[model samples]
Target: MNHRSDLETDGEPDFDNVNRSESECLVGWDDDNDPLKPSNWSNARKVKNIAPLVYCSFLTPLGSTMFAPAIEQVTKSFDSTNSLLSSFSVSVWILGYFVGPLFLAPLSEMHGRFPVYMVCNALFVVFNVATAVAPSLPALIVFRFLAGMFGGCPLVVGAGTLGDLIKPLNRGKVIALWSISVILGPIIGPIAGGYMGETVGWRWICWTLSIAAGFGAVVAFIFQEETYPLILLQRKAARLRKETGDSSLRAAAKPERNAAQIFARSIIRPLRLLFLSPIVSLLSLYQGVMYGYLYLLFTTFPTVFRNRYGFSAGSIGLVYIGLGVGSGISVPIVGFVMDHTAKSVIRKGRELNPEHRLIPLLPVCFCMPIGLFWYGWAAEAKTHWVVPILGTVFVGMGINTLIMCAMTYLIDAHPLYEASAAAAGAATRSLIGAVLPLAGTSMYEALGLGWGNSLLGFLALIMCPLPWFFYKYGGRIRTNPQFQLKL
Candidate 1:
């Protein structure tokens, strides 16, 4: 009972019949096998397109923490010894992360992904260059903020692009691979920044990022293309209308929304959903705390190692090896574990549920508090340097695993609204990442490293029950009418 045309069913264009007296507009994929559909693209082509985009995403976190090892040098250069201001140089970029997604993510949905990729990324590079040559601390922070705003484009849009190209069944592996950029950026930033700041100068941190981002922009310009289905359909409709003089030509199911409406909704939808959805609220809170803690470490790690162990800048960066290696190794392992877990559940004659995807997060939840406690006490006791680094290893593995699980759960929960859901999560995390680190040094000063980290561990303990609660009650919450009652 296929009511669609032969050409449509067979995944071919019906150009021959387009000039007929009557014709229905073509829209969506011609069929599941349509060559132009992103999901149907060759695996090689998908990798080619996504590689540069993912590389560009690395720039955001790279820029976020690249200043960490240089904080002391930066203060000296400006003759301003304020620790708070130095921290601002690092955290203000997060301000842009918070604001960029609100407008940029929606804009990509409306105009298409390529333009955003090109323009915003170019701006990111420009500001990065400006950051390198800044005359004062104020100028440097301002440039950093601008760079972060534009740097956020890829973080916001890249997820949507991957969602477009990859089917849910196959996404876990790619998501895991793709997430390496997120984990490596900050972990490696301080390492590179430490060497450059100690040997060369802190200004080189910004200059180096500028060069890398500039190169990334060139790659994007060459390979990036419009991937949004609606935009593609609209183009097809316009071409058909022009060629056939058919004023009635239109895309199937394309809305008549104007730019303003699209823009407004793009900015508001995530905010609304974030506040209204209990599922989103809890997940955001969990992610926000973890992300904030990550940035706090970026600020505090150098201080701890330098004061306690008397490590040089370059040497202090080496301590990040524990976290970096843990995250790097865990991503692929977690991906296999998640996919295998999902398949195992399906084999038991049970329909797959999103809640099933949450199994990976359970072990991670327990690990977080344990890692924190171990890290705090070991460092407090002035145990061997390896002790605290070992603690960070556990922390890193737990965090990366938790993030993947939460992301997979959210995407599974709202397949159709993946972008909006992700935006909400990113906004919450970015805000925390932006604001929490400002207090990090002050907290360390007041409570010292031991009690300061202990407090964070306590918070992790309170939040540890989240994954279990979600695993058991997620289905009920999802099925509730309130799930649909959007703000």
Candidate 2:
């Protein structure tokens, strides 16, 4: 079929959603054209449906980094001087990000995405409240870890929700918008948390997050509808069986496995994709590197400015604006370019290869290294604070581009393993992000900012060709039997 027909039909309907001889009188959608199918939802309805997911996605990551400025105060509140323990309290939330998705992504597949969002969002609010009232660092760390797990659910399940709502071809813009939400949360977090930490106290940081999350939870519970197709079909089947008194009626698309099996695959398959698939492993590595560095820079950002620039806690948070501005500018640009690249190939009668998605990476990949060099050297030079801040813009643009380009490519490349591949990518990225900052202080101290950043810049420059290498030969790599994952 041509692209237009592909867009129009979205392939043959699942037998459960449209009764056919093959389905043997199984229950299904009202008809082949049922409007309840997420793909068939109206544009306005789609936006309304996704609003909560987008909002929660934005809010959860904010919880992770918004407390960056308050770490010292949070530590002092417990009367401890251990630097490792303090950073651990903050980074453990990211470790929750790693653990949450490994299980949550699969559970969403079993139960459906809507319920997970609701349960996770509400738990997130409750845990943050726990964090606020905790009497000691150990208590605080435990609460924050729980918060991180629930808070990070949207990052795993929300992508699948977006896929449910938007067709593959039109996903570029929505993904870009989603990326901005994910990226902006951390950027905006410190700015808000800084002021609260400086003036009110560190506890308000958690209180504010809980308050914002409570509002988000209520709105999402009201507005977000279930988008997973299998669950929708299952619901319809149950309704049909009840009405018609037909015990045999069941959704044809329903999974054969029990819940235990479903959970096992959720745990194991992501690992398989991460270790067994070259495309997954490599892209995940690149994405993980970007994510790790982001954590490294942001967590250490306060000490950098406080010692060098004599900036207040509140002012250090504002410095995040450079990265935020760069991300803001790149979101639309990356989205447009990604969709255009594939469509342009289609116009020329060429099929859309998954590699088409990586086209943007070739150019934008350089932004990371360049930005690192600029930010590092400028800070070390102490020419002007603004000079270092400007460097973060490139860093922001590069990271945004990776989220859109690399992440989108992963989805396109592994259609069957989308959730698993995504989970793996997210898992490694979060794990690295959580662990790498432990070394950031030492690396900066030993190397100094100029040499430290230049070292990173050179490393980035060396890896810059990764995009082109993949773009050139990604198809063969995808099809290679050795790299193919059975799970």
Candidate 3:
């Protein structure tokens, strides 16, 4: 049996023998500048790896809404006029998002990011093709849900990869850039889907999206590399043990967990955080509600534009452009301000905490409801099309800012468990978005566009103060033992 050398460095064990015990050697980055560490990779390498993931991110949500313009066409083909069912055609995919992250996030923890991402992307492509060729509406919905299940892999895994690649201080901007893919995908989907559905057929929307996803899968398979350090080190340690005949060589500090336990923990831990952790619960609720409101707009926009503004299906799609512009403009500004504020907090002799992320959200809280109120009243009164469009711009900025801040805060709070943290947030938001749109048409029909949206705006106003509460109390909440993952 080989033993460690007596190299007294910081009172830690130092292994000198080739066949030393696992406890005698630490398996991590060789040093601060180690090329193996994702954070230390060149900027070009980082972009090369991250850009595909970002594009995948955009494609997933784009798939979710690409069918928005085709909903009526689909309903007519299926001979179904039930509003709930019509909405479900769009929302069942999101329901799949709720289920996918529960398993995918944990699987990535056990395996690695690249394998899960590639497999999921391929699954997404296959299901999207099935959706395009489905013989019935039920078959189409099932295919769509399957597509979304696979599509959700990027949302969960991408954040973890970003956490691995970027330092905490500089994560905001990269996250912001990644978020652009997400924000733009849904907004742009309708623009294209509307034109296609009106011109060729609704089925072409699925065909086009599947083609795009196939391209994404190919690019990702060719370019993206494994990111999770633990997996890489584990593989390295296995090779070293095989070569050196050392049975004790291990990558992790703790005893190995069985597959069952790891799977259980992955599913349970996020749920615990969602329910028990105040920070997670508040952030999840806020982000989820905002997501639901966005989906609500997906339903309401068509109604308001068609009935009030007398726009064609293709012309109605143009209204989403304001939201696209607003979100694009806000990404850089919010990212810059978030990074600057976090650094300033550190400069002032304060330990950097997730709370600093909320600084950018201070102005955003008021923007959501104000925009909603403006949009509601303007649409109710049948004002100029530009008025409601501008209101959506504010709503877009507000929600985008809130999402960026909440996500960054979650990532910062749980650096080791970023994937799980993101899974919780994604699942919550998806659940809300999936269910909320079902009521959108009825609400608008009963309350009219003005009062219906005003109700949502009021809810936004009520929720606006949540960030302030969390920013003040997050440190204390994080200190709870239950909230901390073993990782």
Compare the candidates by TM-score and give the number of the best one: 2
Q: Write the per-residue lDDT of candidate 3 for residues 1-487, one digit (tens) a residue.
A: 5332211112212222234343544344455566866777889989989999999999988888878877888888888878787787888888899999778876887778989998998999999999988888889889989999999888878877987788767886787788778788889988888888888788889999999999999999999999776676667778877998866766633226766877887788788778877788888999999989988787567666877888777777788887887788788888789878878888999889888888889878788999899988998888889998999899889888888889889978886666567778988999998899899999988998889999999999999888888878778878877666553
Model 1 C-alpha RMSD vs. true structure (Å) is: 4.0
lDDT-wise, the better of 1 and 3 is 3
Looking at model 1, report the run of 10 residues with the lowest lDDT sum. Answer: 1-10
Tens digit of lDDT per residue, candidate 2, span 106-212?
78878899899889988999999999999899899899899999998888888778878888678757876786688779888989988989999989989989999
Number of the predicted model whose lDDT against the real structure is largest:
2
Residue 153's lDDT within candidate 1 is 88
Q: Could you tell me the C-alpha RMSD of candidate 3 in Å?
A: 4.6
Clash tally, candidates in order:
0, 0, 0
In the range 390-454, model 1's lDDT, one tens digit per residue, is 99988888777777788778878876666677778888888898788889889888987789888
Q: Model 2 segments beyond 4 Å from truth?
A: 1-13, 16-24, 41-45, 167-172
Span of 10 residues, lowest total lDDT, candidate 2: 1-10
**Order by TM-score, highest first:** 2, 1, 3
- Cα-based lDDT for every prediction: 0.80, 0.82, 0.81
Q: Between which residue pairs do clashes occur in model 3?
A: none
